[model samples]
Target: MKHLLTIFKYALLLALSGVLMWYAVRGQDLSTIGHYIRSANYFWLGITMFLSVLGYFSRAYRWKMQLTASHQTVSYWNVYHAMMVGYLANIVLPRMGEVIRCSVLRRTSGVPVEVSLGTVITERVIDVLVLALLLGVVLMLEFNKFWAFIESLFVDKYDSLAANRDVLLSVAGIAVLLAFVFGYLLLRNLDKLRENALFVKVIAFVKGLLAGVFSIRKMENKSLFLFHTGFTWLVYYLMDYLAFMCFPETYSLDMKAGLAVLTFGAFGMAAPVSGGIGVFHVLVQSTLLVYGISKEAGIAYALVVHGAQTMLVVLMGGISFIVSAIHSGKPAAQKQMSVSR
Candidate 1:
């Protein structure tokens, strides 16, 4: 039953991704999008790929720092390999990358899985805080523009809701019914769920995770952590900004425009889909259209930029997985040689 549920979950996500991809491609000129893709400047795309690696390297370095604060003596190379493997896993299984990454660390460095997971949680918290700050700065600079954009997205539906008392009451009733049903189900299943083996493992993992998260207070060189955190985001923005140079259609766009795109694109990538495949294109294209870019151009840009980065993740992650496996085997190999001698 657990395996069935996992399969169902992946199927549902894939279905949603397909629906979103269809929406993204709807009403766009395929030929024009294709032409733009074919004619795009490879030079800029090369630079974009380079920036993506730099961003990954920075993240791995930051992870090493966090782990060091926790008093783990893992090498930077091992951490980086684990991080890359995680990224590669994400291309297929959404958030499963983190577990895969922590598993690598546990196998290679003898770190507890739960402890590594805790550090991952800490890193994500820091990332969310940074992303929130950047989003706020972008909104402050373009308040009216974004306000108008948001109003365009939802104002008509809200106005209609205000005029329709019966529709509103029905929706509220459904929501209440759902809450009641969910609460009842939870109460009924609580004991059995707690006794499940998976549940036991999760509780143990959470305990270790908390210890890792608290290690942030013990970190050395807080300044270096701050610098890497800032630099990682900066590199991310540069990847988006340089991708704009690949097409003449977006040549007139400035850094601020790229920031807006990056901000929305970030939300799309955060969705639970493999590599944000379809959702990223839709959100990014919608965002570009808001900035007066043509739909075809938006499609082209989204395909090129997001697709290239996804490819990079797959390629580098595969290589890193191999490297990590080889590196992790060295200790056993050395011990075997000594025994033979």
Candidate 2:
């Protein structure tokens, strides 16, 4: 039943991606998009992909720093392999890669899953903060260009929410009351809960997670970690900026435009869809539209840029999976041989 539910979940997500994809390309001329894609400067894209590789390495090293601060002595390659494998998994399954990567690290480095998961959560929180910061910066700088588009996205929803404000407030109040009551009950029963095996395990896991999350405070080279973080985002921005040169329509776009793409595109990728397939394309296309680029050309650029990055992940990730798998099997194979002897 659990397996069935997992399958259903992925299937539903996949269907949603398909629907969004159709909506994105619905009125566009495929041949025009194809023409734009074909005419793009492949050399710039190649450079972008190379920078993407650098970004991946920097990100893995950053993660290694986090793990080291947590006192888990995982090797750099192991972390890289696990991270790449996780990226590969995400191409097929949205958000599942986090747990899968943590599991991989546990298998390879003997790191506790809950600890790694906590680090993952910390990483996500930091990323969200950075993205939000960038989004704010872009919106502030390009208010005239982006305000209408941004407003269009939220206005309808905001209106609906305002219309139901009273009911929503009542529901929210009830939720808070129930949460408080539940917390009170849990506190009253804390001693009995501590006696339960499941509760004990949960407590242990939470402790490990907290340890991992706080590991950043114990990092030895905070400056280096910050450098890596900045470098990774720089690479991300360059990927968008350089990709602009790939097509004539976007070639004349400036640094601020690239920043806008990086900000909005990151949001698109953060959406809960496989590889951010449909959502990224749509958001990127819409964003480019704000810059006076036609939807056809914008989507064409999105397709090539996203396609190249996706290919890179698949290629690098496939190799990482194979290498990690072989290395992981060695210990078991040696153990079996020892048993036979």
Candidate 3:
């Protein structure tokens, strides 16, 4: 039943992606978009791919640092391979990559899954903060240009919530009461729960997870970690900025436009779809429309940029999967041989 539910969820997500893609390209001429893609400067894309590789390495190193601070001494290559394999898995299924990568690391480095997951949660929190910061900066700088577009995206939902204010308030109050009752019950039964095996295991896991999350504070060289974080985002920004040169339509776009694309494109990629397939394309194309680019040109740019990065992930991630599989198999093979002897 669990497996069936997982299958159903993925199928639903894929269908949603297909629907969004259709909506994005609905009225546009495919041939024109194809022409734009074909005429793009491949050299600029190649540069972006190189930068992407650098960004991946930086991210892996930063993760390694986090693990090290947590007192788990995993090798650099193991961390890198685990991360890339996780990325490969994400192309297959959204959000599963986090757990899969943690599992992979455990196989390769003996790191506990719960601990790694805690670190992943910390990483995601940091990323969300950084993305929010960038979004704020973009909005402040380009307020006049983007205010209406941003407002249009949220106004209806805001209005709907306002219209249902009384019901929402009631719901909130009920939720708070339920939370307090649950907390009181839990406290009353705390001793009995502590005696339960599953509860004990959960407590241990949460402790490990918290330890991993707070490992950042224990790092010996916080400055280096910060540098890598900044460098990774800089590479991301450059990838977007340089890709502007790939087409005549976007070539004249300035640094501020690059920042806007980076901000919105990151949000698109963060959407809970496989590889951000259709969502990224739609959001990016809409964003470019605000800057006077036609829908056809906007999507064309999105297609090429997204296609190139996707290809890069496939190539690098495929290689990592193969290497990690082989690397992981050796230990099992050796153990079998020892048992036979």
Task: Tell me, by lDDT, which candidate is best.
Answer: 2
Prediction 2 TM-score vs. true: 0.96
- Once fitted onto the true fold, the runs of candidate 3 whose alpha carbons sit more than 4 angstroms away are 329-341
lDDT of 3 by residue, 1-341 (tens): 99999999999998988898898999999999999999999999999999999999999999999999999988999999999989888887998999998988887777898888888888888999999999999999999999998998999999999999999999999999999999999999999999999999999999999988998999899999989999999999999999999999999999999999999999888888998989999989988998999899999988898989888989999998888877774545665799999
Question: What tens digits encode model 1's per-residue C-alpha lDDT throughout 1-341?
Answer: 99999999988898899899888888878999899999999899999899889889999999998888877878898999999999999888989999999988877776787888889999989888877887898789878778877787789998898899898899999999999999999789989989999988987878878879987888878899989998998888998888899999998899998998888888888888988888898888888887889888998999899889888988999998998887775545665799999
Q: Model 2, 200-319: lDDT tens per residue?
A: 999999999998888899999999998998999999999999999999999999999999999989988999899999999999999999999999999998899999999999999999
Local distance difference test, per candidate? 0.87, 0.92, 0.91
Which stretch of 10 consecutive residues in model 2 shows the poorest summed lDDT? Answer: 326-335
Output the TM-score of candidate 1: 0.84
Q: Model 1 off-target regions past 4 Å?
A: 152-204, 328-341
Model 1, CA-based lDDT: 0.87
Q: List the candidate numbers ranked by lDDT, top first.
A: 2, 3, 1
**Shift in Å, residue 113, candidate 3:** 0.6
Backbone clash pairs in model 1 (N, Cα, C under 3 Å; residues 3+ apart or in different chains), count: 0
